[model samples]
Target: MTFAGSLNPSFYQSLWQDCDSIYMQHQSNCLTLQDNYQVNVNLLLLAIWLDSHHQLLDSSNWQQLQQILLQWEQKLLLPYRKLRRLSKAALEQAEYQQMLDVELMLERKSQAKILRNLKSMALNEVSSTEPESNIGRYLTLFNLDSQDYPNLGQ
Candidate 1:
């Protein structure tokens, strides 16, 4: 088992590349692409869950993960928190804007769901990704958007 919260740059890079590929695959409804998406999610989730429970890494690797996580929390999760703190109407507006962004590159429903979940799971409330911002960075790193999940809302 790896450390509950650490990964080296190489490992993270591989996963990041995998995520990009998955995002591209998701652009269409091809059968091969569909299989790739499932495989990608499974691989990412495994790494995330493992990192959540174990700190499997050397000091240097841990530090690298920390820096990467911090960057993600700042750039992505922080904005998410700010958006979530807004009034309900504002939240809906922000969600709608995201739904319309071309770079979102996901099915309409999938993109909407991710935004909604992010609204509910304020940056501070998501422990699997916060405290040290583990899950938060993973999502950003993997390019997976959340649609305000009530279950994830803290």
Candidate 2:
């Protein structure tokens, strides 16, 4: 179905910021997903946002979204995130903060790209027969359990 209008990127940014707060509150689990599983937290938040809006991506759309996020994660976010983490010990406080600001800027760019793609796509409406949550579907691709993570949408 067609979107009525373009989604505001700030809305997604707000969702991510709220989820990021939760991640900070529950750092260990988030760190595990980040460090061990390499889960992209922003993508998870996007899944939750889409589910909240009753939007469903067909398999092809879902795969394309994954590919987009994977490109951002692999080529940009991950390396910068790793550098940020590593720099915490090696760099001075001010310099590390600058790195963090830059990382956040990159994250905003990534989110905008995702939202732009979403705006251009034809998404399916969530059907009664599809009882699974979007976040659950997304996590399933990585063999993850929704119960293992904080509930951000509900």
Candidate 3:
């Protein structure tokens, strides 16, 4: 499959859906990473998806992806997430839900941006008998280790 097609929002959403239970299982750890380490869950999920699809990116593409995700996280996701969290108790249910819907929309837009940029790049398929772990490389970007985030390694 083409990189863009494979990296669509639905692909990431489906993976997220499938991994929801795992996330919940390690919710505390995930939250700690999010709150303390400023981890972007979507990026982590993207790394997992890329590895599972055997879409090995060269260092340049990987760095570009990280930059794209960082921009999205800094400008959109993090602020909205904080808003949603802080407003949950103060806002009416409907209002909170609306905010959540907006956040989800923003997330999809970020995914689309990533997909569009990746489609433009001349990506190559993995040629080695055993491709390296994209997840490991991604975690290293955050000074994280898969051992600490067991769900990610899985």
Candidate 4:
């Protein structure tokens, strides 16, 4: 499918539906709800990125690109995410509005950093000749396994 096709709401919804099922299965006491939730969202965002750039990727560079993205997520995105969550919680008190505003800026900065890192990634410096395989590879990149979520299409 083209990037435009992938952007369709039904297509995105199916992707999230599958990812959410897998997340719930692995979301146990070992993780907080915030971290657990991020896993799915991050992976979905990664899927969107990969789909948007499918024509420029192939199996050879796909794994490497995922590693780069994962590292960026862990080092840059996750910390700011925690800060954002804290700032959101502080909203209940009303006095922390200014602090939340600062946190929002910091969080957006980290997000931009991650997006910058992503834009630097390339698939062997050439476009993939076979785009069909990109979706299969991208879907399984996070180990969500479409086979495990056969009902998502419904």
Candidate 5:
């Protein structure tokens, strides 16, 4: 089980409160070419959760996780994301909108795969509320708000 094993998707979803608005305000263009917003945010949330639960993967595993994320981005997420980004321009076309919905589903499946990977790699149960020391680095990489989530006990 992952750090979030005891939790539900909504818990992770809530970490980035009003996500669409937060995303609009967020300026980092990290992963601009390969990532869709959904995959990126979900990965960030997993990193945060793992760190918070003192279950962050070691470097090798982290690298493996990254590779999987990259594969998903390259193979599944990016194309759909690109299409969705063009949705506004194709607004009057119903088929275009349907395509977005299908792509969104595919994107969500990709997220599920990421979550499964994290779950499979989880090696320890959370024993404390304090996060792992290296979590700050990842937070910086993703431009995530460290304060957004209350400590696990809270």
Candidate 6:
């Protein structure tokens, strides 16, 4: 059997139709759940939203979406009060650790100064000489000697 003579839609029209179908399906499911005592407004809205969008999203294999939305709603609504308490606890712990780090760094700096002083004292007891009889290699890499060069000490 041959199927023929159906109109061809533009790319955007086809895309819109697919989107509309998903939305309709989600709305239908959400409305059905409204009659049940177990579904809240938040849950119904979340379900409808997820039903339409989850196919285009990723990788909890789509299983955790409901739990994730619930958690997100909780976080959004009561975050400052709850999270502030948590952050205050974390800050105190961090401050104690920071004090320990500061103490350790001060000790290390003191030790480093003692070691550097000992090193300078040892160097003061030794003698060194400049190389007076050797010639060094020269290069023409940048034609540096082609003109006057700036003083390197700067």
Model 6, 1-154: lDDT tens digits are 1111121224123433353454365554433433332222232232222233321212221223334433544544234324544555567777656655654454334333322322222111111132110000010121223113112101
Winner of 3 and 4 under TM-score: 3
- Cα lDDT tens digits, model 1, 1-154, are 3332243435334543454454454434223322443212322332343344432223233234435444544565435534544534654676756744522333333333332322322122233443443333344443433322112212
Best by TM-score: 2
Q: Write the per-residue lDDT of candidate 2 for residues 8-71, one digit (tens) a residue.
A: 5564456666656655655565567667776666666667667766877655565677788887
How many angstroms is residue 129 displaced in model 3 relative to the true structure, after the best TM-score fit?
7.7
Per-candidate local distance difference test: 0.36, 0.70, 0.68, 0.46, 0.53, 0.31
Q: Which regions of candidate 6 are displaced past 4 Å?
A: 1-21, 34-60, 75-154
Which TM-score value belongs to model 3?
Answer: 0.72
Q: Which has the better lDDT: candidate 3, or candidate 6? A: 3
TM-score of 4: 0.41
Q: Which run of 10 residues does model 4 get worst, by summed lDDT?
A: 29-38
- Residue-wise C-alpha lDDT for candidate 5, range 44-135, written one tens digit per residue: 54455555545645545555666787776778677767767777685767877788788767756756676676555544554565454333
Order of the predicted models by lDDT, top scorer first: 2, 3, 5, 4, 1, 6
State the lDDT of candidate 4 residue by residue for 56-106, as single tens digits: 345544465556556766775567556666777556656466555665565
Ten-residue region with minimum lDDT total, candidate 2: 4-13
> Where does candidate 5 clash, by residue pair?
none
TM-score of 6: 0.21
The TM-scores of all predictions, comma-separated, are 0.26, 0.75, 0.72, 0.41, 0.54, 0.21
Ranking 1 against 6 by TM-score, winner: 1
Ten residues in sequence with the least summed lDDT for candidate 1: 145-154
Q: Compute the lDDT of residue 90 as modeled in candidate 6.
A: 60
44 in model 5: Cα distance from truth in Å? 0.5
Model 3 over residues 16-54: C-alpha lDDT tens digits? 555455566556766787778776665666666666666
Q: 3 or 5, which is superior by TM-score?
A: 3
